[model samples]
Target: MSDRAEKQTGGLAAVAGAAKQAPGRGLPPVHLWHPEHCGDIDIIIRADGVWMHEGSPIGRAELVRLFSTVLRKDPDGYHLVTPVEKLKIKVEDLPFRAVTLERDDGRLRFTTDVGDTVEAGADHPIVVETDPVTGEPAPRLHVRGDLWARIVRSLFYELVETATVEGGRLVVRSDGEFFALGPVGAGVE
Candidate 1:
């Protein structure tokens, strides 16, 4: 491997080790880490929710899951953070894809590709923005701490199916909060 490639591999290993050692069984406290910024890594999260390293997809599911625990979105950009290092990475779109959705007792819970389960509510709001060029809706759900997951097409369709017309808008309720899926009769049916 080239020198840079070797360095990246070493960096990844270090971060992985730190993540394993992190306290608690749930998600790591990436938000609490204020490590100094290390240089960028050649990791890219594609728009389709595939993670690429050195221009190739990372085939190891466990590794991806481990890295996802340390992912944090700062004011500048997305990063993989450890207690001692914070490496910037490129994200073509959101860092995750909402693959599955479940409704339980009037709450919409979404599961992301990386195994995060988040319920849509005031804290994790769902937002739909229209693509300026294609004029299509791009819906997203806040996962945590400024990180968002793009709701997959199938799940978005499900949302549209269950949505109710309220005050001239198509809305869905979760956790006592009403979220507008889209304006009523705006070609969203």
Candidate 2:
């Protein structure tokens, strides 16, 4: 490995050690930790929601999930912050992707690619943004803190399939609340 890659591996190791020290009951309070900026890492989250490091895909799912716990998005960019260090990482799109959806007990829950389960309600709402240039759909769901899960195209279609028009808005009802997907007359697809 090059010297830069070698240096980043140490940061990863430090993050792994911190993850090991955290309690397994809930996620680490990354928002509270104001560690010193330790520069950027080689990690990159692709538009397809794949996590890569050093030009290769990270094969371990658990490790990826662990690193995600420390992820934070600021006005600058996304960073993986531990208690002692904060390392920035590149995100092509959103840091996470909602790959699956479940409806149970009149609640719509989304499962992210990294195993984060978020329900669409008052706490976690869904929003859609159309590209200004291409007019492509980009749907996102608030997960936690500043993190959001990108709703994949297929899942967005599924949402659209179950949507209904309410007050001239294309919306989906979850947990007794209506979330607008788009205007009633606009073609979301």
Q: Count of backbone clashes for each model? A: 0, 0
Q: Evaluate candidate 2 by giving its C-alpha RMSD to the native, one decimal.
A: 1.4
For this target, which candidate reaches the highest TM-score against the unseen true structure?
A: 1
Q: For residues 51-101, write the lDDT of model 1, one tens digit per residue.
A: 999899999988888999999999899999998999999999899999999
Look at candidate 1 and tell me the lDDT of residue 136.
Answer: 77
**Best model per lDDT:** 1
TM-score (C-alpha) between model 1 and the true structure: 0.95
Worst 10 residues of 2 by lDDT: 180-189
Each model's TM-score, in the order given?
Answer: 0.95, 0.94
* lDDT comparing candidate 1 with the true structure: 0.91
Q: Report the poorest 10 consecutive residues by lDDT, candidate 1.
A: 22-31
TM-score of 2: 0.94
Which residue ranges in model 2 land beyond 4 Å of their true spot? 1-3
Query: Across residues 1-189, which tens digit of lDDT does each residue of candidate 2 receive?
Result: 887878799999998888767657688888899988889999999988889998999999999998888899988899998889999999998999999999998899999999999999998999888868778778899999989999998999999888888888788878887788998667872
